[model samples]
Target: MASTSAPARHVPGFSAPAVGFEEPFAMLEACHERVQRTLALLDRLREHVRQQGADESARQAARDVLRYFDVAAPLHHEDEELHVFPLLLAQAAPEMRTLVQRLQQDHVDMVADWAAARVPLQALAQGEIEGFSESAEALFDRFAARYASHIHHEERQAYPAALHLLEPALLGRMGQEMAHRRGAPER
Candidate 1:
């Protein structure tokens, strides 16, 4: 089978930019960029599987997608939930409260979506399946689309509003907590 790995390299934002937790909002934005890259990889993996079957490249792509959505994505969402959303809920207007609530729900929905999406990906990664079923393909599409929309909402609306509300001290605390959770050493 022809290697499909070459295209994976061209997926934008595949290598995340260096953004330390010292700038929490920038870190979160960088996570969004990573999310976009991973989603692109997921789309490409799906296409590759359809055309080329479960080769090593496809297996590696499946593993890559699983690792991101399983580990980093959850941590990123937790950072927003624990640090960003609570602040917005307490201090911002009712509209912001609603927005945070919606975002929180998006996090929940995404977890569920990932649960469903992970099954086929796990199978693909293990080389048990040659390609996604039609239903799995649809699930993948919805998963990627939902993330794209969710990231847009957070970036264009939620992050800016929350950033305006946070003081320097809170930002420092937020950064520290974020780094500590990831087990990074104190700087």
Candidate 2:
């Protein structure tokens, strides 16, 4: 007998349509929006696992979170490292230079934190939420907190500094490189 229950639908945290590649700054902002949504999904997954014990919804959420962080995040970080950070490192004022260095270190810390958080998420994806430990939840909390702070710093300090320093040509080149890195067709 077919189950009468309706198929589960994704509960997205927010809806921010992706912008065009030509608008590189806008694209970065859009990516940040997606990151926020994915992080929220991670938080929801924790609750779902706790309450529902790795049901289909929890499994799906784990997979979604894993896919985003594993795939999209690296590209986004590369976009910042390759396209955004260099300009600030080379040309920004002394105060901004210090900020850029801190931002660069934040990227490294984020990668480590994500590695720690991914273990339980991987288990959750495999319908093994029983294996989720308190340590994993603590790691995830730290990871999410670090990401929030990192995003704030980048949006407030690093991105604006890069925008101010990069002229139209450099910005175009950065966008093109970003698209190429993602295997996306350049517009």
Candidate 3:
């Protein structure tokens, strides 16, 4: 018998993710979309756990959430730290500097919390039913609160600063770099 690799599947009308100097808005939008996706999954996982129906598929879904948390979420945060936040700091007044600094502190705090959070998520993924649901729900609440606050901070503070400080040309460049760094398709 001959073995053959299957052809790649494509969703109809789907293009590669947008990528280029034109994509900062889209890049930010994609991160927010991922946040929404994880939040929905978290809600479903909690529901499954409540009903005591968190079987193998539930466990696998739990694992998928963790994978995105580990990979995409942290990278997004790092991108802000390296690119977005520093640019704000460089141009903000002394009074405004403290808020940017606080945002930076939030990033550190978030990363630390992430390290602790993995324990509960792993427990969920492994189907450790004893306290997994309660622990996970609590962790998820904290994570959600932190994220809600963080994104709000960006919206109210950092994003405004970026828009104010960066020229149209620089913003365009930043957008391009962000899209490429995120591996959204090459354009």
lDDT of 2 by residue, 1-187 (tens): 0011113322222234447567788888878888888889888878877776888878878888887788678778888988888888899899988988888898899899998889888987886656468899889889888888989999998898889888899888888886676655446
Error of 2 at 187 (Å): 3.4
The true-structure Cα RMSD of candidate 3 reads: 6.3
Predicted model with the maximum lDDT? 1
Model 3 scores a C-alpha lDDT of: 0.67
Candidate 1 TM-score over all chains jointly: 0.90
Error of 3 at 84 (Å): 1.3
Candidate closer to the true structure by lDDT (higher is better), 2 or 3? 2
lDDT of 2 at 144: 87
**Per-residue lDDT of 57 in model 2:** 79
> For residues 54-143, could you state the per-residue lDDT of candidate 3 as single tens digits?
688778777877776776677677667766778878988876678788878887887777777777768868877534545556767887
Instruction: Name the regions of candidate 3 deviating beyond 4 angstroms.
Output: 1-21, 128-136, 184-186
